[model samples]
Target: MPQPVLSLDALRALDAIARKGSFAAAAEALYKVPSALSYTIAKLEQDLGVQLFDRSRQRAQLTSAGLLLLEQGRELLQASQRLEEQVRQLDSGWEQRLRIVVDTIMPWAPLWQLSADFTALERFTRLQFSEQVMAGTWEALLRDRCDMALGLAGEGVNAQVELHLLGYAEFAFAVPPTHPLAQRVATTPDEPVRREELLAFTAVVVADSAAEMPGRDSGLFAAGHVLQVPTMQAKIAAQLAGIGVGFLPVHLIQQELLTQQLVVLTTEIPRAPVPLYLGWRKDVVTGQACRWWREHLLNLPWQQLLTPGELKAHV
Candidate 1:
């Protein structure tokens, strides 16, 4: 007998079933009836003369042979997608998708508005957003995981990377109005708090998003306790609740400062204004969608992108 020839549809059925975990779910995703999907998988298994999924499990799970095939099949599918995308790009210069990695410190409202405007252009490019903190922003761009990076902290000096200065943002050591630090600052307005006093309280810091890479500490005591949260918003909330005190981007908490909800603490070591940059890989040719986004961001004033507050006056 001749060797079995696999069809793309059959491979897709296997993938969908594996991805969705059940034939019923996969059928819904593929816009097919459950029975049809089941028949397709059965036919594929019969043709290959091997069991793709173990019948005992409630969820569609791949056997060792199935796992091997699925791994290679995904690569083949991805290559096919790339080929199609390239052809489409040749015909119309718009990219199929654009991935942007942004630092969580940046305000989201303006970015969302910009994305809405981009969508209005009808360029048919999908926008993917990933939030990264500190070094993770740089790492995402270097690893080719993102097409563009916004609000990056430091200079990435490499021939393959292109960097542009966004602006500088000042960070303040803010504490809740009811906190001891705030009360002390209110009473002793002229004196700076000692490091030991500051260390006595827990520091609220945003946990770095980097995987496998070493994370950086922005404004936490070296020997003190910390309450690590996933996002910058959570950090601010923790600080507002008097859970912990740490450095926060001034623009992010301007409203709270104006309302005296959060008070700034004068510390022995005042953090210098951090400079942010926009970075993209120089190696990859900037696609139409990416170029459009870059131009749009470059034209936007940094002050307008941040949360509206009297940060400059406070700093």
Candidate 2:
């Protein structure tokens, strides 16, 4: 009699073993006991008539046959995931579950309102927000882990992805109220301040993946005199302490600007406004819930959200 084919559950068990390097780890990841996982793997090997793992060592290692099986297993898993994604997308309209990723810098109030509008349309609608940096958002969209993403336009934005420009936000050179720029009138397009004027001041910049600084090569800001801080909130605190002048999102500083805690630099250099894009995979079909949220964002009057001066301060 011929051996039976391996089951999807068996393939999953083997793949998990390969990924986790031990039966115990795989079992934990799969929410199964080690013995159960071992039994599944043993059954799989029996069906294939070949040993999938070298059981001699403390950690499970893939045999040559195991390696070959692993490659095929991964392909099968990916196909299964894709199929499930398609089915989920088709049926998601009635389910009310919407997964979305947004840039960390995106305003929270507007997003809350967007969610409220979506839920009002369908009370069962649910929103999941994944906070990621510029590049990570695109990755989430491509992986089908998220239905939509909002982020700044960047080079890695795939051509296969669809991007909608929500609006442009100006970048402003901000400093404490006591800073020299605080005393001067805001800079205009024709009279933009020279880079040399900024060099004399210290610049506190956000560091690491959390930071949303503009592309360095874009000539949007001077790169040499930067003091790298970790988070946007920390950068703001540094500015308040009068440590340095850093480029900040205009909307984020609205309260500071009004209370005289922060002041915008006056320069002829045009405010470098970064265009924000709402991105989604071009090939993925969105459900009604996703469509409703997208249209809600498109219809938002962003102009009314911030003052004209605040908008120009950053761009």
Q: Which candidate is the best by TM-score?
A: 1
- Candidate 1 lDDT tens digits, 1-315: 987568778778888988888888889999999999899888888888889888886665789989988999888888888777667774787888899998988877778879989989856688999999988887898899999999888654667788888788778888877888778877787777778887688988788888756887656665368888888999999889888888899888877988988877777878887778888988898778999999988888885445345442212
Candidate 1 clashing pairs, residues 3+ apart or interchain: none
Instruction: Score candidate 1 by lDDT.
Output: 0.81
Give lDDT per model, in order. 0.81, 0.69
lDDT for residue 37 in candidate 2, whole number 0-100: 95
What tens-digit string does per-residue lDDT give for candidate 2 at 167-186?
77666677775666554434
Q: On a 0 to 1 TM-score scale, where does candidate 1 land against the true structure? A: 0.69
**Candidate 2 local Cα displacement, residue 128, angstroms:** 1.6
Which residue runs does candidate 2 get wrong by more than 4 Å? 1-92, 121-125, 154-157, 180-194, 208-225, 229-231, 268-270, 303-307, 310-315
Reference-based lDDT, residue 281, model 1:
87
Model 1, runs deviating above 4 Å: 1-90, 303-315
What are the per-model C-alpha RMSD values against the true structure?
Answer: 10.3, 12.6
Report residue 98 deviation for candidate 1 (angstroms).
0.5
TM-score of each: 0.69, 0.56
Report how far off residue 238 is in candidate 2 (Å): 2.8
